[model samples]
Target: MRVTLSLFLAAGLAAIAQPTLAETLSFTLDNQTPNMIVQFHATPADGGTRTELLKKKGLYGGQSRKLTIADGSDACVYKIRAVFEDDSFYDVRDEIDFCENDTYTLAD
Candidate 1:
């Protein structure tokens, strides 16, 4: 009985120690506006610092860039920000679902 209890306790501790794996989401970003998209950022929908996706590159008008992001949690939701070369920024306002959505477009 003691051996069985120890086995059960070990199993319970192992289960508790397991960490939640992050989910990866990939989608296409389309630029329809006339200005060039200079910077792009994504962050947890709840509240977190934005991480740049462009890697010091820029997306021009009529161009599309594929982006891949790992969700910190299972929600798969993120806040997207796009800055243009014309000194303007676009805020998605926290409604983007990177998991379910196939594409995000920036327009005038």
Candidate 2:
């Protein structure tokens, strides 16, 4: 009986130690504008300081980068902003459902 109880306890502990699965949002950025440098930013749609997903060195035309955002759930949305070499910018506001989209492209 002691051995059986020990086995049960060990099984319970193992289950407790297992980590829960969290949904994550992942996507690729594609640069389609030729001869321009591009930088990317991401922020929570509800409102927060922007986080630079890409910085300093920029993505050139025809280049693509893969990014992953963890702890993303259906309840949350994100805003993505793209800055160009000429100081011009374009923003994709809170309209993005990250879980449903896999790629973002920057173009002229």
Candidate 3:
């Protein structure tokens, strides 16, 4: 009975030590405009803080990129904003259900 108790405790400890899976949102970004996208912001639809999508890189014209956001928030909808190299802003919409959409395209 002692050996069985020890094994059960060990199994319980091992399960407790396992890390939880991180939640993340992923989508593809398509740049169809003639300008280069210098900045990308993904803000929650609930008026919370915003997240920067670009990882120190620019999305050139006609380029496609896969973006992942793991802001530790339970927000499924976000307001998308993209800034071009020409200092122009591109707002995709008021708010988008990023969890439902897999691809977001920016066009002229």
Candidate 4:
């Protein structure tokens, strides 16, 4: 009887200790501009200055990268910025719905 009780308790504890899975928003970036390096950033759409995701490692022309936005809430829109090697940049402020699209292409 004691052995059975201990086994039941252990099984209960193990079930309680199981961790929950977290939801994540992810996307892919494709650099189509020839001869230009690319860097990108993802920020909240609420006009705050906090950068939720940044890729400073640089992506060469024709390269692609996958990025994850760590927002677990119901936020579906975000600000995106792409910086080129020539100091020129493109900004999309609060106009992207990341939940519906998973791929972004950077071109001239």
Q: What Cα-based lDDT does every candidate model obtain?
A: 0.83, 0.74, 0.88, 0.73
lDDT of 4 by residue, 1-108 (tens): 999999999999999998755447788888888845555776667654444354567788898888887754446677888777888888864478888999977777
Which runs of model 1 end up more than 4 angstroms from their true locations?
Answer: 1-5, 71-73
Rank ordering of all candidates by TM-score, starting from the highest: 1, 3, 4, 2
Give candidate 3 misplaced runs (Cα > 4 Å): 1-22
**Model 3 lowest lDDT segment of ten:** 18-27
Clashing pairs in 1: none
1 versus 3: better lDDT goes to: 3
- List of clashing residue pairs for candidate 3: none
For candidate 1, write residues 20-100 as lDDT tens digits.
787777889899988889988888787765678887789999999998775455557788889888778988875798878
Task: Give the TM-score of each candidate.
Answer: 0.82, 0.63, 0.76, 0.64
How much is the lDDT of residue 30 in candidate 4?
82
Clash count, one per candidate: 0, 0, 0, 0
lDDT string for model 3 (21-47, tens) is: 645999999999999999899988887
Q: Candidate 1, TM-score vs. the true structure?
A: 0.82
Q: Best candidate, TM-score-wise?
A: 1
Better of 1 and 2 by lDDT: 1
Candidate 4's displacement at residue 50, Å, is 3.7
lDDT winner between candidates 2 and 3? 3
Sorted by lDDT, highest first, which candidate order results? 3, 1, 2, 4
